[model samples]
Target: MTTALLPWSKFLICALLIGLAGPVLTRSGDAIARLTGLSRSWIGLVLLATATSLPELFTGISAVAAAGAPNIAVGDALGSCVFNLLLLVLLDALSRDEPVYRRVDQGHILTAAFGIILIGFVGAFLLIGRGALDIRLGHVSIYTPFLILLYFVAMRAAFFYERRAGTIAFTGEKGTETGLAGAVGRYLAAASIVVGAGVWLPFAGLEIAEVMGWRASFVGTLFIAAATSLPELVVIVAALRLGAVDMAVANLLGSNLFDVLVIAIDDIAYTDGSLLASASPAHAGSAFAAVIMSGIVIVALLYRPGARFLGIIGWISLSLLVVYLLSSYAIYLLGH
Candidate 1:
């Protein structure tokens, strides 16, 4: 029993560490953006998104290596994508002024759409390769390399497009100074925290699941995904406090994109044909629901007719998610 409970203890410790690192990482990311003269959009998309997502990357890679189950990795990535979108819904509910959906420009909407389409493209490819949702071993042979190239190309395109279109202005915040030494120190500190949390969380999650007699998929989909997503939660709250609605929206959307791209990366790392072979069907359903929820979020943002209406959509999404979880749990109990 003690052995079974060890993972949960580790998970709690990791969660506390991640929670502590959140603000520091945010401060460091903001400092780095100022030091590099990068716009918030770029900073959110590249730096903040990547930093916050390191946990997912680490957990996904570790799951792949340890279980030889590419499905868990895929589900985790997709599940994170869904969870990130849900963060936006939470932000929408929490915002007091103009709904964040209305305050942000169309750039975020485009990015979210692009992310959804990208996921669909990848999902379709996987589906076609194996004639099902199963991850194909050789699917990475073509899919993974192409996705890596595509991600870089898309990023470059976004940068130039934003620059040329004047969609995002490259202005620094007030009283923000660019100091090399400070920037280096903050970067290293943030990197260490993120890496440490990433490395420790999965093992903690595994231990917890064993102790509770729960499946790894449940822990991966719910506990670990929620724990690792702390950075997004931190960024949204900070952005809201600063009244940087656009930045907040951009961060959530960009994080989802990053999570999906990580799927392609995991696929490449996997030696098997199908990434989903080892995942519980319930986990796959959760991932599918996440993709659907993301699509709904995009639609909600695009149709932003009023703040109240937007809030209603968010509530709907939240309700649906709760129902999905309850139904999924019920099914799991029945089967077990």
Candidate 2:
């Protein structure tokens, strides 16, 4: 195969591997969840969420350091939020019981709300970076340090709330208890598989964008973003099937929140001017879409919409899916 075909081929293989790894991740998460006193949301949001976000983390680092394409790094991080929110539709539809919104905890509204703020920070910086607004200490955006601080604070807030909420929101049964060593081993093994596929995704993304002469922003936003997020898709389906509904939803929100942090790392790796400033203005669209979609989720969690339409999912799911499709299309046009 020509070099052009190489990346597409590798992308498919890695995608398949990510799918196969999902169930193992879900099962291992259950063991770990039971071992810890934290509820399902806590486990999924903190541990599983961070684990699955490894793709964006590694992809961002590689895009800047190795690929030397900060735009890809920017698109992947911002676009992943849109992709992650869109997965709510899949999670809701796959739910054989009540709508997923009804199943997960109301506490997730805090997560969704926090996500909106983080994405908004990104959007603000992207637009500001376009002009002479250089709120920077050095090569980095000043917002980078502030965002890092906010992320930890948000995490602490979420942790306290979930811990106090008890199991009222958790739908899944705790897994059978295992020795701590066994749980640790299983968690590490499953995480390793996910990390392996995640690490290779950026290479395929850069090559395909170059061969097709497609903008890195477009390729990263849609193709690379969706591809790297395959783990979230798999884990959501697996966790829901295993009766861990909160884990499924919490994982998405946590990952989206974490996705923004990748930008800070990208800023450091780029070695150029501000990474956000280096990105096309089109990325603001993705960041804005994240805010809007996260609003939809917060509404669903607060309202707990009982009404289902357009098939298996609820109205929130449909609305979110539409917004994402429109946003992706908008990104495409902007790229052209």
Candidate 3:
């Protein structure tokens, strides 16, 4: 009995540690952004997003390098993309006064669009870049460099767009008085905790897969993906409570972008072969699911629906939930 519960216990512990450290990361990130005079949207997309995604980044490396589970690596990254979009449903539900899509800046559509592009790129690589069609540049996919380049381009684009749009607002009772050096220090400390926990996460996931007789793709996508994403959930809620809606929205969409970039990093870490090529094709389903969900977000941002369907969430949130459930079911069927 004790042996049976060991994997889950370890997984939960890592999740708890990440959850506790996550808010600290966000606060420190916010401070750094404030001190540096960067826009809130930019901060959320770059600083907050990267801090929250530390677990995914570390987990991917461990999954590919130590656990030798390429499926887990790929599934976790792509699955987190879908799961983050699912968080939009939660975000929409929490905003009781108005629809979340209508409340926030439309500039987020840019982030979501970039997310779709990156995720679609990954899904395309997984589907077509297999066997003879696969392209490699010395143990890594050629897509690796493109992913990295695209990420930088996306960041630059978002920075200038947010600046031009003049959407730089920091809401809170008090300003961030912490010195820049102090904020950086706190960020690093919180990040180290997340990194350590993230390193152990893949091992726990591997054990859970073995003990439950489940596919690594399923375990990684559904279970491990949610676990690593706990930090984002925590940060998003904290940001919303502080009235930083753009930060919350940017964090979720930005995390998706970074999650795809993690795949490129995973490919480099995975010395065996191309990480995407080695992963199960079922993961492509999650990738495309994310792409569809991102498209829904773009529509929601443009349409800006005011009325809620059942007085709980808007039509956009409902669509997101439906797609998320169907995609999970499909992945379960394929993994099993």
Candidate 4:
């Protein structure tokens, strides 16, 4: 009972804090976007997305450094991707005025496609492990450097693509304009709250995993990931409600892309071997799941189907839900 209370209480508090942080972050970020003369999509992709993704960053590093559970970190990264994709299920449903995809700019396809590429890279690296030759400089994969490099490349590429895409509509936050410095200050404060909660999340998750006798990957993928990803759900809902379509979509894709980068950070933190080598192959299931859902998202962007299946959401949302469930089950089975 005592052990349960710790994670549960922390989880409840952190989850609520992240939920509160979401709208504040998004609003401040939107004002920052306007002030900086950048598009809301870009702000959502970089600033807001990074702020929300802090949990994964903190949780992954904490899991490796403090908890010695690199697999949990790995699971959180992959599982967070799965969970972020699942958020679109709600995004689509709440966006009942129009199908979600039709409202966003086509530039998002670049973000989604690049997300797939990065995730595929990590998945393939883990799956091939020792079967392929390792160019390791002690503990870290040579690819770790490449992963970091590729992430920046992906960011720059998406940044330029969106720049060229031109004129993304940012539904401004009326009555919330506090000027540039004030917005920056507010964004940072809320971000700190989010990050603080994020730092505590993995510890609780690790304890709960131990108490429950669940595998690190399973616990990380489902529990820790779900907790860390609360900000994404909050921002997505808020963005959708605000009618910032691309902002909502870009946040999820960008967060997933950054989440994969956490693997590189984890690789550095572990000091034992490539973090990939240390984690269960069950994680590749998440990478593959991320790829599959990303593909469907890209398809949704390009296809933009008119019909809402079963009078609710689109085919892609349903497909994403199905894929996530099946992949999660497979990972759990493999983990046990």
Best by TM-score: 3
lDDT of candidates 1 onward, in order: 0.66, 0.84, 0.89, 0.85
Q: What residue runs in model 1 are displaced by over 4 Å at the alpha carbon?
A: 1-4, 67-71, 125-128, 131-141, 167-181, 272-284, 307-336
- Number of backbone clashes in candidate 4: 0
User: Which window of ten consecutive residues has the lowest lDDT sum in model 3?
Assistant: 168-177
Candidate that would win on lDDT: 3
Segments in model 2 whose C-alpha atoms lie over 4 Å from true places: 167-178
lDDT of 1: 0.66
- Candidate 3 backbone collisions, by pair: none
Report the lDDT tens digits of candidate 2 across residue range 1-336.
487788899888877776676677777777776765557788788878887877888888888888877878889888989999999998888886788888887888999999999989999888886567866777778778988888888899997786577653444544444565677787778778777887788888878887888887899899989887888898998888788888999999999989988888788777777888888888999999999999999989889988789657788999999999998899888963
Which regions of candidate 3 are displaced past 4 Å?
Answer: 167-178
Candidate 1 or 3, higher lDDT?
Answer: 3
Candidate RMSDs in order? 3.7, 2.6, 2.3, 2.5
Q: TM-score for all predictions?
A: 0.83, 0.93, 0.95, 0.94
- How badly does each model clash, as a count of residue pairs? 12, 0, 0, 0
lDDT of 3 at 298: 97
Where does model 4 exceed 4 Å of error? 168-178
Point out the higher-scoring one by TM-score: 2 or 4. Answer: 4
On residues 1-336, what C-alpha lDDT tens digit does candidate 3 reach at each position? 888799999999999999998788778877876777666678789888898898899999999999899988888898899999999899999998999998888999999999989999999998888988788999988889999999888888987787677654443234455577888899899888989999999999999999988888998999999999988898888888878888889999999999988999999999999998899888889999999999999999999999898899988999999999998888888963
